[model samples]
Each structure stands twice: as structure tokens, then as C-alpha cells.
Target: MEPHVWPLYGLRITTPRLELRLPDLDTLSDLAAVAAAGVHDEDEMPFSVPWTDGTPGERGRSTFQHLLGTVAAWTPGAWTLSLAVRSEGEVVGRQDVGANDFAVTREAVTGSWLGQTYQGRGIGTEMRAAVLHLAFEGLGARYVTSAAMTDNARSLRVSEKLGYHPDGLEVLSVRGEARTFRRLRLDRAGWEAHRTVPVELHGLEPTLALFGL
Candidate 1:
């Protein structure tokens, strides 16, 4: 991508085993195919939006449109960095870190999903470490927040592994019934204490202004 026109596309975050970047159209299509194959079973939803409930085609379209929309609608005051997670050479998942009035609040929220076949490995944990590295060390964010359904043990485990303290819980309607969720938070000090992975930021200098840095 042309950095002058869309500098966010030039941003990259990497861990020892993973590389995250804004996917070009062709790579986005590949990521969409991963979504189309399936992200979870028909029974449970780890996400609040229920984006994976439909047919494979519908899920793929939702993934593509949601990501593209975030890029189109971004502004420095409020934006979502939705980067495609790459392992080895394959597009495996998506990770997001977003904020509103970030320059003032110095806070951001994280969200993500992985294809079903890729779930059991430690990729979710490593990719998350990459973005948290971007938020605190790269962007000078003071805090990051995330939530997971109470029944979603894997997501909770990832948060726990990353040194996020359980802030509290909330109830929400999902699919149909009420669901309880665990809210987690990590401050810069906490992240520094428990961060276990080595992460690197590249192409970040040119994108600082876009993040209100």
C-alpha cells in the first residue's frame, strides 16, 4: 500500500512466530476463505456479535466487509487497527486494537478470532502479545481492555496468561439467552511484569500521526 494515502497499511507487528499486518485485497480474500471454512462449532459463539452464525458464504462476507469497513471509517480520534495474523506464510486470523479519543484517554480495547483448525495452538496468545506490544510499547498507551464470555475458557486463559486482572463481570444477551462475561484489564506496569513474548514493531514511525501519537 502507498504510505502517503494509507499509512496504517504500512504498520506491522511481529512476534517470534507470527507477523501481523493490514492485509491487501488479495490477502484479505485469503483470510476470508479461512473464515468461510469455520471459526467455531455451530453450537457456541465466543464473540458478542454472533458474526459466525450464518452459512460459510455469509460468514466470509461478514469478515471481509467488517475489516474493510474499519479501514474506510478510521480517524485518528477513533480507529480500529484490524490486522491479519500470519503464521509462517498463511493468513490464519484477525486481531484488533481500537480506541476513541485515544490521545486523551490513552486507553484501547482488543478483540480477535481464529479459524477452528488453528485454535489449539498457542497462536492466539502470541498474536495478542503482538498487539499489546503495539499498544503499550509502540503507541504509549496506558491501558488495554478486553472481555470474554464466562463459558469461553480459552479466551479467558489467554487474558490470564497476559497478566490482565479480572476487572469484573457483566451480563448480556447473546443468541437468545443471557450470558455472563468476564471483563479484564491490563495497565502498562502489569503488562511489563507478565509479558513473556518478544515482539517487534516495524513501519510504525510513519503511522504515528494516524494513531494520534
Candidate 2:
């Protein structure tokens, strides 16, 4: 019998020290454990959505469910490629590259989180570069966008380093409190010119249509 494969079964994005790919059940469980350990400190909430606001076990369960939902709800016009980020063959975090109305917009959004233990290193930047490569080169995306809380200097800096231009701001309610977020965007030319990491993608042909490419 043939091995069960997902729409993006064998897709992968690799950097010098990291690998990003769709997580299988076992890998997803490992990813959940990492998330359960925690991402940010208890007092802080970096994401607009408080997905990690619950208990550690709850966070892990939520991570697992969210990833599964993305796959089950996928459509040609909308998709969320939630790839597990691994370092040295161990699940460390998650990097999500997503799109809406991609067939018409040709635009994508990127979001990610690293385990607290992995925060200060340059891993976040490198992982993002891999996804950017997959977006513009592998998926033929025309533009990519991202957002960071106004206070999230690390995230904003990563976007700046990748040549994403400031696209103004938006206010959103986070945990019942209103907060300002800085929006950023990068075009194909800008991404190509600023991209430095050499990324390799494997087995994306069968899933290209699912992303409306």
C-alpha cells in the first residue's frame, strides 16, 4: 500500500540550520509539546489572538487542533500552510504561511512563533527567510505581508531585515484591550533583492493548485 500523503505531503523548506515542513501526526504531537512549554511570558501576549492564553496542556491541544483544522478546511482560494519548524531534527516551533483569495490577489501573509528557549537566536529570521523563498519563488507569489504588534521590536526588526516596507498600522482588540499593530509588505522584486538565505523546496507540485498558484 502507498503511504498516506497530504496535499502538500512532501513539501519542505530548509535553511542552513532549520527545516520547515507540514507535520505528520507524530511530528505534530512533538510540536504540541514544544508549544505547551510556552512561547512568551505569562504577562505578555505578542499575538493578536490569545491562542496561548490558556494552560500549557490547553495550548498544546489548541495547537494540534488548529493545524488539523487548516488541513481539513483547505480550499483552492484560501489556505494556511502551517509547517513545523525543526532544528537538528527536533520540532521547535511553527511557521505559518497563508493566503486568502490567492488566485486573484497573489498575496500571502506570514506568521510564526519560536519556543521561549529559542527566542534570542537568529533562528526566527532564518525560518522566515525560508518561507519567504517558498512564497515568492516556489509559489510564484507577487507580494507578501506581515504584521507585528507595535511593541514587538524583534518581529519588526526581522521584517525590516527582509526588506519589508512599512504599510501603516491597524488597531485591533487583543485580550479585550485595544492595541496598535504595524503592517509590513514586500513585493517580489524587494524580496528577491533582499533574500540572502539559500532555500530548497521539495515536493510542492501536487499542492501548488491547492494554493491557487
State each model's CA lDDT, in order. 0.93, 0.91
Q: Could you tell me every candidate's TM-score relative to the true structure?
A: 0.98, 0.96
For model 1, the stretches where C-alpha displacement exceeds 4 angstroms are none
- Give the Cα RMSD of candidate 2: 1.4
**Candidate 1, 103: how far from true, in Å?**
0.4
Model 1 worst lDDT run, 10 consecutive residues? 1-10
Candidate 1, 140-206: lDDT as tens digits: 9999999999889999999999999999999988898788999999999999999899999999999
Which pairs of residues collide in candidate 2? none
Question: lDDT per residue, candidate 2, 15-120, as tens digits?
Answer: 8899998888999999999999999999999999999998999999999999999989998888899999999988889999999998889899999999998888
**What local lDDT does model 1 show for residue 81?**
92
As for candidate 1, its clashing pairs are none
> What's the number of clashes in each of the models?
0, 0
